[model samples]
Target: MAARRPVDDTTPHGTTPHGTGYGALLRTPHAWTFLLPALVARLPYAMLSLGIVLLVHDTTGSYGLAGAVAAAAAVSQALVGPQTGRLADRHGQAAVLVPTVVVHACAVAALIVLAHSGAPDWTLFLAAAPAGAAVPQVGAMVRARWVHRLAERPALLNTAFAFESVTDEFTFVIGPMLATGTATLVNPSAGLAAEAALTLLGGLAFAARRDTAPAPTGPAAPGVRRASALASPGVRLLAVAFLGLGTVFGTLQVSITAFAEDAGSGGLSGLVYGLFATGSMVAGVLYGLVPWRSSARRRMVVCYALLVLGCSTLWAMPNLAALTVAGLFCGLAIAPTLITGFTLVETLVAAGAKTEAFTWLTGSIGLGLALGSTAAGQLIDRSGAPLGFTVALAGSGLGLVALVTMRRLLLAPAPAHRTVARGGAVREEAAPAARRG
Candidate 1:
């Protein structure tokens, strides 16, 4: 398919003939219409994850089993992400999202029953699998819409992604606290039910928006699969970066929990995670505000350097307080890296493949986190929490290495253009940096 040209926003009614750019992008009737669901959908994920260990422990009376159940859900999501994305692409996001929400609701209901009914461990695991499979692709779909709406405004697009990443940190921080606290106060099973209700509400809210729909694609020619959207080299490299980052995130979460247990302050794990999230949230807002004349590649290199320094500090810290400080530093880099990388991917990917590309990206993150979290859990069990932290730091280093090696292939120049002003005047303005993988 031919590349879609950016729409000129200078037109007299603030919209272009091709219907592209920031003005057109934000022209939708309700901006929060998209943001609300995106924000709400995060609640279920946060609650489900935070409550998983507690619920499973209550049901099975095994920490090992609880951790395993968590891993099972992560793996299931990873396995199905691409398939689900493909379906969303072939049909539409609603076709996949609506049904998935129902499945998720049913699955949540079943798991609650299984947890309460003294069901066998195997049955509980089996019942949980389908629910994991039903998670809606809200993150992916919202991003796809961003691409579709902001096709002409790359900078705004980048800022939007940065906002999304920040929101994710905020959601996780609050979601887990709410989930764990509610479960402790009310009942473990109630947490899961609450997540079910949130998922339905958030997923439906996002689906209800016209802007949230997938962009129209080129008619499928012979021998084309919907998954082909993510086949580009740029998207694939972004996926690799996502995989590395996801592993780092996943391993860090498990290690922090283990560390809390080892320090005889298991109760403080959620608090520390909250601190980490707070730091990231603060950094995210600042990231958008910082003025930088350098290229995105430069920004990426700087961000990675900060991340490496922060991750390495974990090994140097000797106490929980120091570790929390280190986590804060590391957290600060999370949104910047993700925002820059995803924005770059959005620019490079084919217009028609936006949803699929994002799905692959999201899937890479889910898979990496799954593998990292599970592996970290096992390592923590065997060696200890510090060793797990060391392992996590090593993963971050590897990600930095990967980013450096691929730097040349990944950094595409930002688009620049000169325009002829009316009355025979001439003017030149640089387009937002052209994103390339």
Candidate 2:
């Protein structure tokens, strides 16, 4: 398969071709058409695990069980994610997403039914695996589209990635509120059902935009096997760092809920977590507007350092108010770190391997989430909520260490050209960072 070159005709007339501004990007033809559905499709990513925790605990009366079920889903997703990405890369996004969304929605619906039916505990656990596995990698696909659309404009690409990061934070904010509120106000089953409906609708809508999708790859040239993104030393280190960051997120979600339960305000857990996401959302928007002089690697390190400092402060908070404040402070670093890490991944791999590479990153986060939720749940069960904060602090510390120790690998220069396979022709262009000032 040969790389696809950028199409000069894609950009609409009267748009600034070289500008990194958001307005210019949004004004581009079919930009919002692609973004809106992708945003909707990813709402489940924020809701599913948290909804599972709430629903299972309400039915089974055990946070440990709830966490385990959620962890099961995360682990399943982690295992299956790359394979799904591979399929999307080799085939097409619609070919993979349409069927995957149907299975995922059905699985979620089944889980909801089982949860409400007083079924065996094992049944819910068994059902959650497929639900997670079927989750569409919306973020990666969207990023891939941006790579295709903005191939010639690195600055605009950075802005687009920043926008995507903000969208993720926004989804986290909205998803948890929707999930928890539905569970608390109506019924747990309703929350899951809503997730199912959204998954089906959004996934299909996103997939229907076939024009924006990347072209399917043909067979690799003889003696030129595609390199696994995980095999790259830099990507491996970055994945470990991402894993630790995922642990921080998973632990915080479960721990905050435990804290709310202890305070007799369990219904407020979503709001509290949403506030944390709100901080990151705001930061992501601002971060996108600025043109950074520092490299993505340096920016990532600084973000992690700030995150460590923020998480460390949670240890001293005496009440929910303090915890909320600490959470907001900690969130400031989250989006920046994620955006920089993803940008680094874009720089680290060939264009043909992007979806798989990004999925590997997502899988690392899932692995970390599974570990964090399981560990934090046990700690909260045995000790208390405050101890879970200690676990989060430790995870953040580990993430910082990983980034620091692997600084050299991360700082390596990005490839100078990327070969993209499109429509039986190969297109080569300057690497992502090559055009950056």
Candidate 3:
């Protein structure tokens, strides 16, 4: 067995301290209860893109049509995902997830039936939209639960966020493999069917973990209103940054596939891409162990800068061997950046809007993926496989520029708590350190 690392209680700024390590964080009451189900509920997200592509491609025999159908789902999901989160924040996660999971199951089932029946392409898009839109914001809700569970304990919150990112990386890496292999090996519809099955089962189970859910937001006093998470400039900035990461994700998927096919090793694409997630998971585990002094906002900037530098090397990688190694190095910055961004967002929004804020960041990534994949696909067709990487690099460059230029906007200015009292008058109180993360 590995030796236990001692927790330092004297460390300032929630860096390294008592029970902040991964082992300790997992030991939190009922941690596995909520986390395992949340992880299962979220695995479908990783499978959906490839699952859709496979299921649709098989039925239509037109990759272009299949892609368009998938894109519609992705775009609608991006637009509607945050709204589910907003509702969850107000009504509690169970209230939102129960109904959302039902809707998602029906929508996905309808989509599968429509495709298999040779239904018109428009009908497929119609089913796809709702199917995508109803995807539970389980990941965001999980983070909100962590925030609530670890409140007044920032170090553990940091560890929890890092662990979340690591799991996300793991899911994405594994989800596609499960989806694709199941589709090809069993039947085209099997992957999507399995995805729906997992979501239904896991989402309901997660919803039942109400004890860990955040307190629902109650009605504001008459003549007073709560702020939407998007109203915060910092939240918007982070959303755009996540969008940048999404673009990189989209670009890489297509570019790697194309590169592998060109090299007569298409079968190796998944394993090659898996390397990227491997690097991210490794970095995320290590990230949670260190005790950093800088604010999450500063860490976001630095990690993103590293991301941009990493992306710069992708376009010039000469072969699969070099690209695979470069991909690993480039991915090293991703989880750290993602973990820092989530930590920062936790500080930027109010308790009532935290889930919404997290959803916006996640939804932005979905939108970015759609945009990036579309652009990269066209570029790859017109030029070559290597050109697809340019989209990833460009997205990173633009996002870095935006991040650096608007770094000030990334800080949280809203008071940590708001009081509505005495004839609906509201008073705001700031907890600067807590708000700064």
- Counting clashing residue pairs in each candidate, in order, gives 4, 6, 0
Better of 2 and 3 by TM-score: 2
Give candidate 1 regions above 4 Å deviation: 1-29, 61-63, 116-118, 222-227, 315-317, 411-437
State the lDDT at 392 in candidate 2.
Answer: 74
Full ranking by lDDT? 2, 3, 1
* Model 2 C-alpha lDDT per residue in residues 63-175, reported as the tens digit of each score: 78888899999999988997788778878889999999999999998888898899999999889999999988888888888888876666677778789899999998999
User: Each candidate's TM vs. the true structure?
Assistant: 0.82, 0.89, 0.88
Residue clash pairs of candidate 1? 410-437, 414-433, 414-434, 415-434
Rank candidates, TM-score, best first: 2, 3, 1
**TM-score preference between candidates 1 and 3, better one:** 3
Candidate 2 residue 278 Cα shift, in angstroms, is 0.5
On lDDT, the leading prediction is: 2
Best-fitting candidate, scored by TM-score: 2
TM-score of 3: 0.88
lDDT to native, each model: 0.69, 0.83, 0.81
Residue-wise C-alpha lDDT for candidate 3, range 91-178, written one tens digit per residue? 8899999999999999999999999999998999999899889989999999999888877676788888889999999987887778
